[model samples]
Target: MKRTQNEKILQIQNHTLVVGIDVGKDSHYARAFDNRGIELAKLLRFSNTAQGYEALDEWMRMIMEQKAKTEAIVGFEPTGHYWFTLGDHLQGKGHRLGIVNPFHVKCTRELDDNSPTKNDRKDPKTIAMLVKDGRFRDVYIPADLYSELREAVSERERLQGQLIALSNQIHRWLDIRFPEFITVFKDWGGKTAQATLKNFPTPARVMAAGAAGVLQVWQKHLQRSSLKKAERLVRAAEKSIGRTAGSEAAEAALANLLAQYDMIAGQRQRIEQLMQELLLRVPNAGKLLEIRGIGMVTAAVIISEIGDIRRFQDPRQILKMAGLSLKENSSGKHRGKTTINKRGRRRLREGLFQVMIPMLAINAEFRAMHQKNLTRLVNPLNKMQSVIALCGKLVRVIYAILTKGCLYDAEKMTNDMKRSMKAA
Candidate 1:
């Protein structure tokens, strides 16, 4: 956790070789500089292959030998998945890698030539200079179980997006083809509703099938079939005001969506199992589940995003990483409302907020803390504000549980507010 600029600058001493790279999908550009920010070699362009990594290694070796530099510190913008392989290769070769923020690069690119001209050749130099000035963060490439968990979470997120899209499509189909379908069954994805949709898609079809026919379809999946519900479905179909045109094509579209929905549903279940299995393997990760409202998926997501909590020396880093840390916007005489920066991992932030809301609903300790934040005499927070404040507190509790292997203590989490009030 060498967080400060001085600590970072201290790492880049006289004998250190600072190499900056501009990473791309198929190619990368590299520029070398010393601690003094002096260019030591011409830019080297290479492919995104093993041979290219070796070539970059050789180039760095040649520069080190000529410039009397011993260790290499490589810096680059983490421009998506393009940098992961390169970062892994560089680190595996015994070189330390640093990630300069793209925003920082954009801001600093004009410092040298007073022009914001971004290119492969220009970015490497900009990246290198940033590294030389100690304006980069050390890279933490997760290994083994952490990697598996991260991939599992990412796959789950993708499947979740697809499922949402398919769900929306299904809703649209129901609205157009069978508007009254939702009135009978609140959830269209339910077993009974899905069976009805598969057997009778259109209002005309439902009317022709009759209530007995709808009950027959339901019995195939469920042990019990409701004739009364089926009769209601029949009545709605008879009184339906749904479109009759495009019925065939609409059925086909809904069939495709239903198929996709089933496939994605299966995939989501499988990925969740894998995520939980991977989560169990992580040391002390199960401690997170000890909390009242947190579940396997929530614990897995937090663990995956944090990627080995030992890397974080402080819980504040965790808050900042999750974008839960608040900042005040102000000028000399004018001030603005303080809010969370939201500049870190979006998944981490979203997961924390989502879990916190439910935690407030189900977990007594979190709810108490949230209530205190809202009703406290000084600087009381509103409902949503209290919820956001609790999110940061949850970050600390998670950090401690994973790093310290601590058990969940409602007393500590709520800070014994009852005692404080009594004492007062």
Candidate 2:
């Protein structure tokens, strides 16, 4: 079934059935076309159900029966989570599936029928034609356990982001209610600070409690040095001129926010447990963990996002996926500066960034590289840029470690790096 570049693309035009699916939440719309781009069947829309799946299967079966020699390729947009169910169903039936750019779909809509309009029916055919022209990649669904682990980790990240946002909000509230609170405890969630917030949400409440009473509250709630910090907090609260909000309202909001924070924290813990289990089973994860700054969570994030390292033949592909690759804008007369192309999997890029930070402090190779890049003649990047460049290099290092199944070596790596620089 192999063909030359042009031949492979042209071969799709001979396919018997081209199916376009407009995926949605509760239902999906499908349209079919023949080899000649002639609409064959009426728009077939189905619910997201067992019966709907059955109907979809029957429709494809009928098409196969009619054109025994031609193939069936289904195309759709990667519209968030809406495409997953349909994709799963298509995969289950052993039918070939393809995806089209949502942007491409939108641009082609007006020109497809020259109607200056859009609807579900026309979209399916256009998508099918796009697929027939070999304009899509077959989406990969990792094996079941890997997929579940990936989802769990992704959910944990989302929850963690929300927790951070709430914590920031609480910090802002404290600034208005008790400006000196930050000086007392750096974080609102600290043992001393949370207890203080829960006991005396407002400056007035702390004043009412007095130094001795506030100390007792801290002693009861926190196990720190006999509530010494708590006594200071109370004194600051009494002398502070920070604005006050209503006691009942303030208490309720703080309580509810803390409750949500705690709940999300628990979910994150469970996610970590699941990730630990999954990482132990993934091939060579322990070796990855041996690398400085690569923790269980960060390692899992990289492994899960990157699926099989074999898919990337070289480190550059991995770097590109992490959005660590540079984008150069140059013309015939003018040479433009190079900037990072941040157009890849954001989470993968973020995971690599997190890995780079601790590595900068612990990994000798990374520290050296960070220092080396800072001396560049052109626009030298800041600390963050150096870390990002290290992140790109880290991707290569990880690929080497995973593929070669060897331990990380700083000296050998340094020599190889020197050779590469000389060649460059």
Instruction: List the lowest-lDDT window of 10 residues for candidate 2.
Output: 1-10
lDDT winner: 1
Candidate 1 residue-wise lDDT at 238: 95
> Candidate 1 — which residues are off by over 4 angstroms?
419-424
Give one digit per residue, the lDDT tens place, for model 1 in 384-417: 7888877877888888788888888887756666
Highest TM-score against the true fold, candidate: 1
Mind sharing the TM-score for model 2? 0.87
Candidate 1, poorest ten consecutive residues by summed lDDT: 413-422
Model 2 off-target regions past 4 Å? 1-16, 34-40, 114-116, 220-223, 226-228, 312-315, 320-331, 376-388, 422-424
TM-score of each: 0.97, 0.87
What does the lDDT read for residue 240 in candidate 1?
A: 94
Write one digit per residue (lDDT tens) for candidate 2, span 1-424: 2223364466565555788998888988998887677777778999999899899888877876876635777889988988888898898877777778787788777766688577777888778877766666556677866787688788878988998998887877777767887777777887777787877887888878877888887777766645567677777776787776475777678778888888888888998998889877877667888777789999889888887776666788777766778999999998997778886678888899888888888988778778877876666678877887788778877888888888888788799768856765
Candidate 1 displacement at residue 355 in angstroms: 0.5
